[model samples]
Target: MGSAVNDFAGEFDKQRFQTVDDACKLVLKHFYMAKVDLKAAYRSVRISKKLPFRSKLAPGIFHKLSQAVRRMMSRRGFTIVAYLDDFFICERTKKRCAQALAVLIALLRKLGFCISWSKVTDPCQKIVFLGVEIDSTTLETRLPISKLTDLKSELAEFLLRKHASKKQLQSLAGKLNWASAVVRGGRVFLRRIINGIMRLKQDWHKLRMPGEILQDIKWWHDFMSTFNGKSFFLAKVPITSVVTDACKSGAGGFYHSDWFYVNWVEDYPFATQLHINELEVFSVALAVKRWAQNWRGKRIIVYCDKAATVSCMIQ
Candidate 1:
């Protein structure tokens, strides 16, 4: 019955459930914050008017129905970031934060939504929301020490194994993906694991560990051992721009007043094969390699003529 509903249910808008990253973005700059957890959130919604036969909320439709809660919160002019039933309220001042929290609680109670006071937190400079420790004082987010310890143990156990089921690989991938939110540059290390998961033919298959996958896992294990799982919000403005172009014969790019051009040898395999998109991407890569040292610790905007090259970079 659950599978049938999930399979046939209409698609819900992604915006219906605010993402953790988006929530973090909203509260990162605020000095004061609080958390509100709605008790029995799904059960609190009365579904009789929408589905007379069903008394409980179906998992598929809950998010869509929960849009009402978000709308109500927004209409009240509160600076609250909500992910499903959990709400994080942020303000620049303590007084404002307190007022906002009080008003939010009263509103929820008046609307018949139960607030779990035991789980709710008062306004403060630091609070754990959705498993990530958000510290307004430091302007940073971190994975709690307990989560880091558990992740390290899991990675160690996985490394000792020669083969693992597809489910195990997927579970580990999910954990790494979540951890990436608080660990800068962590996503770059996940490519091999994700590729390995894609190659698996069945859930029950115990696939042998690949060298690349093992290398990536080993890197994670070593890096996490000395690394503090904290990421500071940085400004994203591009510090420089590079314009690149490529043709069948050659590829070239310019960084500011400096420019570079490379002509493909007559016997070059890719150029002879007419791999224009590959050459276009290669032009950007070459430019980065040549000028990376000068652009370290800063963002660079790359302009390419081919849409294919841009799409590849985006992915």
Candidate 2:
């Protein structure tokens, strides 16, 4: 059953769960939050014996069942998000939180879903959700320390091995990707490893360990070791708009004030022989660097024409 779920029903996850960033934003906007993990979430669902587990239709059937839970909670006054069996509830007050929890548990029980008693956190307490630690009081979010420790342990074991197999390297890259989500400027740190993995041509176990890879691993560990919790503070400054554009001649952008005043029009220098995509990215980078102080500890939207640049910013 587990193998079938992993191989064929895995895509069901994408349909039901919001992005981690979205989930964090929802939690931050509310006051009280609770995270609950459904015990044996998938096992609780009974499949029809008429259909084979490996069939493509089986995933959709399971996904529909999960969707039913989401729909039931939608009418309630609080925010409830579910990724498979894990449900996160966010409400304004302790009273509303307790009410939301009671409603959720009752609905799940009514639907024949078993609850993980130990994992059902108190609604009034600060909780970790979607692998990121969130403090309900301050609305700050950070990569969990325990996750970093586990990653380091896995890397330590891999470092001692003479050679890493393809699967091992892939797993390490995944762990790094997860850590990079909440770490500012972390994806750039991962570029070398991602490029190295893509260039593999030799047998999995026969490939030698690259010195560059080792250096990168060390750097990653040291950076994470010193990490104090990074806060995502609420926006206090009112930003108007930041528009970015690039041309063969130069790259530049202009930011407007919330009052519709033209703060400045920036004409930035650019290197020769750069492609369109590079220039597009450079324009946004320059604008951010120029206004870093003005926008520090504030939320702002960056508008750009290039889809590739926007996608990179999102990742």
**In each prediction, how many residue pairs overlap at the backbone (N, C-alpha, C within less than 3 A)?**
0, 0
Q: What TM-score does structure 2 among the candidates reach?
A: 0.74
Model 2 backbone overlap count? 0
Please identify model 1 stretches exceeding 4 Å from their true place.
1-16, 28-30, 46-60, 188-219, 236-242, 246-276, 282-301
Residue pairs that clash (backbone atoms under 3 angstroms), model 1? none
Ten residues in a row with the worst lDDT in model 2? 258-267
> Residue by residue across 26-131, what tens digits does model 2's lDDT show?
6645578877778877688766776664565555566667667878888765567777677887877878888889898989998888999998877764777767
Error of 1 at 56 (Å): 15
User: What C-alpha RMSD separates each model from the true structure?
Assistant: 4.8, 5.7
Among these predictions, the greatest lDDT belongs to: 1
For residue 226, model 2's alpha carbon misses the true position, in angstroms, by 3.7
